[model samples]
Target: MNEPISWVVAYPEIFLLVMSAVISLVDVGVKSRLRDTTYVLSLLTLAVVAYLLGASAASGETLRSFNNMVVSDPMGQWLKCFAALAMFATLVYGRRYAGDRDMLARGGEMFSLALYALLGMFVMISGHNFLVIYLGLELLTLSSYALVALRRDDPQAIEAAMKYFVLGALASGFLLYGMSMVYGATGSLDLAEVLKAIAGGEATLKGSAQVLVLGLVFVVAGLAFKLGVVPFHMWVPDVYHGAPTAITLMIGGAPKLAAFAIVIRLLVEGLLPLAVDWQQMLAVLSVVSLLVGNLAAIAQTNLKRMLAFSTISQMGFMLLGLLAGVVAGDSGNMANAYSSSMFYVITYVLTTLGTFGVILLLSRNGFESENITDLAGLNQRSPLYAGVMAICMFSLAGVPPLVGFYAKLSVLQALLASSHPLYIGLAVFAVMMSLVGAFYYLRLVKVMYFDAPTQTADIVAGADARSVLSLNGALVLVLGIVPGGLMTLCAQAIAALLA
Candidate 1:
C-alpha cells in the first residue's frame, strides 16, 4: 500500500509491451513455420497482465499517474483485467483457425498486434487526457485494420480492411477536431480541468458555450462510430462479415469492454456538466440502432452478418444505461445506471466470445461456416456445441436462465426506476425491440435442433477450445441465475469512478 502497486499502474502495460516484442522476436527464430511458440507466449503474457490488473483492482486505489494524464482506479483496472482475459480467450479460440487458414504461415504478427491492441485499450480505459484517449483509440483501430486483412489473399478481407481504415480515419479526425474545439473553449487538454472549467461557468460566454456544444456533437458522433451505433455504424456489418471469424471475434468482443470504459471516462467522468445535450444524442442513436439493427439482422442469411447487426442493436441497448444516468440532471441514479451498462457490456462480451467460438469450431481449412444454414442439424452432429450456441443465443434473446436475460432486466430496471416518463416509454420500446430480436435468436436455435442434416461430419475441436467453450456457456447460464456477484462488482467499479 505504501508504494501503491497500481499507483505505479504502468507496470502491467510496460510488461505487456516488452513481452510482445520478445514474443515477436521468438516467433521469427522458431524455424518451424508453426506459431505455437508465439501463441503460447502471448497467452502467458496476457495471463500475467490479467493477474497484474486484478491485483491492482483489488487494491482499490484511485491513483492518478503520468502527470495526471491517466487515472488508475477500480473501474479501469477491472476493465483491463477483463480485456486481457478476453484477449486470452480470443487467442485460444482462434489459434487453430488461424493455423488452418495459413494466417500464421509467415509469422505471428496477429498475436503481437492483438496484444498491442489490448495495450491501447488499457491506455484508453485509464486515460484522463483527451489526447491520451485518442492515442489509445488510434492504436486499437489501426491494429484492427491490419487484423481484418490478415488473410491477405482473400479479397473480402482486403476490402474490409480498406473500408475500416478509411472510415476509422474519418472518425478519428472528427474526434480530434472535437477535442480541439473543447480545448479551445475550456483551455485544457486534461479531462478534469475541462470538467472544472465547464462546471465553474467559464464556458457560458455566448461563443464559448456554442463551441462547447458543437464540440460535444462531434465527440458524440465519433464515439458513436467507436461504439458502432446508428448512422455511424457503417463499418461494423461489413467488417464483421468479411474479416476472418477469429478476427471478427477479436473486433466484437474485448474492444467493447474498452469502448464502454472510454464512454464512462469521457462522458460520465469528463463531461458530466453537458449531460443534457449528449444524453439526447445517445437516445436518438440508441433508438435508431435498435430499429435498424434488429430488422436488418432478421434478413441476413449469413451468420456473421447477422451477428454484426446483432452487435449494433446490442450496443444501442447498452447506451440506454448511459443516457438514463443523468435524468433531470440529478446524479443520484448515476452509479446504478452506469453500473448496469458496465454489467451489460461485460456479459455481452462473454456471450459474444462463446457465440463466435462455436463458429470457429465448425470451420476448417476448406470450409468457413459463414451461413446460418451451416448450423443446421448442429445438435445431431454435436449436442455439446449446439447446446453452447443455444445458450448464447438464448442469452442474446433475453430468455430466462441465461446471462442476457438478467443484463436486459438490469438495464430495464434502471430505465423504469427513473421518474422520467420518457425513460419509461423507452423501456417499453426496448421491450418491444427485444421481442423483435427474439425471433432471430430462436430461429437459430430451431435450425440447430430441428432442421435436417446438411453434413454428416461430427464436429472436431481441440481440448482447449472445448474446455473454454464449456466454461463460457456455463457462465452465461449461471450468471443469469445468480448475477448478484457481477452486478455488485460492476456497481463497486462505478462507485470508484464516481467517487
Candidate 2:
C-alpha cells in the first residue's frame, strides 16, 4: 500500500517550488534593468520558506512522506533554515554588486535561479531516497551552471561555467553509477532499507561485500569532488576565481551545508555497515586535503583562490569529525561526532558569508576585488569593512575569540574522544597544517593594515549589505565566545536522529 502523502511535512519545499515558478514566470513580464522586483520577491519567498521550516521543526516529530522518499526532521529543518538565511544574505550582498556589473540584465534569471538553487538544496537535504537525492543534485548543479554563466559576455565566466558543467556531470555520473551498484547489491533505493540490508548481512550480490565496497569507493570520490577535497579539487579555484564574486558567494556558502547533509544521508545513514572501510578512505583523504590545501594556499596571490584552498582545508577538518563517529565497534559517540561536524560546517558557512561579503563590498562597477593586493590600505578606505574582513580571516585561520576557532576545537575534540591512535595522529597533523594555513590569513591582515592603497576610491555599499556583513562578522565572534547554544542545538538534532 502507498503511504499517505504528508503535505505539511514538505510545505516549505512546496512553497519554494511554487514561488520559484511564479518568480520565473513573472520575470518575463518585468523589464531587464528592473530586476530588483524579482530580487525582492525571491527574498520574501525565502523568508516564508524559513518560517515554514521553523514551524516544521517545532512539530518535533520526524515525518516521512511519499513512501519514505522524503523526510522532515530537526536536522534537515535547521540546515534548511540556515541555508535559506545564507541565500537571503547572499542576495542582499550581491544585489548591488550584480546590478553594477549588469549581471542582472536578463530580467530575473539570476534571482530566480538562486531561488531554484535554494529549492534544490531543500530537496537534497530532505530526500531519503537515492533517486530523489540525485534529482535534487542535478537541479542544483544545473542552476549553478547557469548562474556562473550569467555574464555571458565575460569569457572567464563562460569558461568557468563550461568547466563546472563538465566536472559536475562527471561527479553526478560517478554518484549515479555508485548508487546503481548499491541498488544492485542491496535491492533497494531507500536509505533505511539499504542500511538494514547491509547491517543484517543480507545484501546479496554477486561478490557480496566486495561489490558494496567498490561502490563505496566511487561514492566517496563523488562526494569528495562536491566537497572540493584534494585530488578532486582541481575545479574549485578556477571556478571561484572565474565566476563573479556574487556567484562565488552563492556557490561557496550554502551548498556546503547541503553537501554535508547528503554525505550523512548516503554514507552515515545508509552504508554505516561499511564504516570500517570508508573510515580508512576518509582518513587518508582528510590528511591529504589538509596538507595540500593549506600548503597550496600559501602560494596564491589571488584572494579568491586562496579562500578556495582554505575552503578545501576547512572541509578536511569537517571530515575529521565525520571520521570520528565510527570507531572499531564503538558507535556510542556517533551522535557527538556527527554533531561536531555539523557545528563545524554551520559555523564555516557563516564565516564564508562574511569573508565573501567583504570581497563583494569592495567590488564596484568594472572593478573586481580579487587580488590580495586589492585590499591594500583597506583600513584607510574603510576601517569598518577592513575589520569585518579581518575578523573573517582570523576566524578562518582558527584564531581565538572567533567562531572558527571553536568549530575547529569541537571537531578536534570529537577526534580525540575516539581514543584511537590514528585519529590522534591525524589531530596532530591537522593542528600543524592549521598553523601553516594561518600564514596566508595573517598575510591578508598585514596587506590590509600595512600596505599603501592601490586605489583611493571609497568602499561604497548599501546599508543592508553593511549591516548584514557586520552582523555576520559579529556572529563569528559571538558564537566563538558562547558556542554552547548552537552546539547544543546541533547535538540535540543529531542525538534525536540516533534515537
Q: How high is the lDDT of residue 85 in model 1?
A: 90
Off by over 4 Å in 1: 1-7
**Deviation of model 1 at 439, angstroms:** 0.2
After TM-score superposition, the amount by which residue 431's alpha carbon in candidate 2 deviates from its true location, in angstroms, is 0.4
- What TM-score quantifies how close candidate 2 is to the native fold? 0.98
As a whole number from 0 to 100, the lDDT of residue 217 in candidate 1 is: 91
Each candidate's TM vs. the true structure? 0.98, 0.98
**Which window of 10 residues has the lowest lDDT sum in candidate 1?**
1-10
Q: Residues 97-189, candidate 2, lDDT per residue (tens digit)?
A: 998888877566888899989989999999999999999998999999999999989999999999999999999999999999899899899
lDDT of 1 by residue, 427-456 (tens): 999999999999999999999999997877
Q: List lDDT for all candidates, in order.
A: 0.92, 0.91
Candidate 2 stretches greater than 4 Å from native = 32-34, 204-207
Let me know the TM-score candidate 1 reaches against the reference structure: 0.98
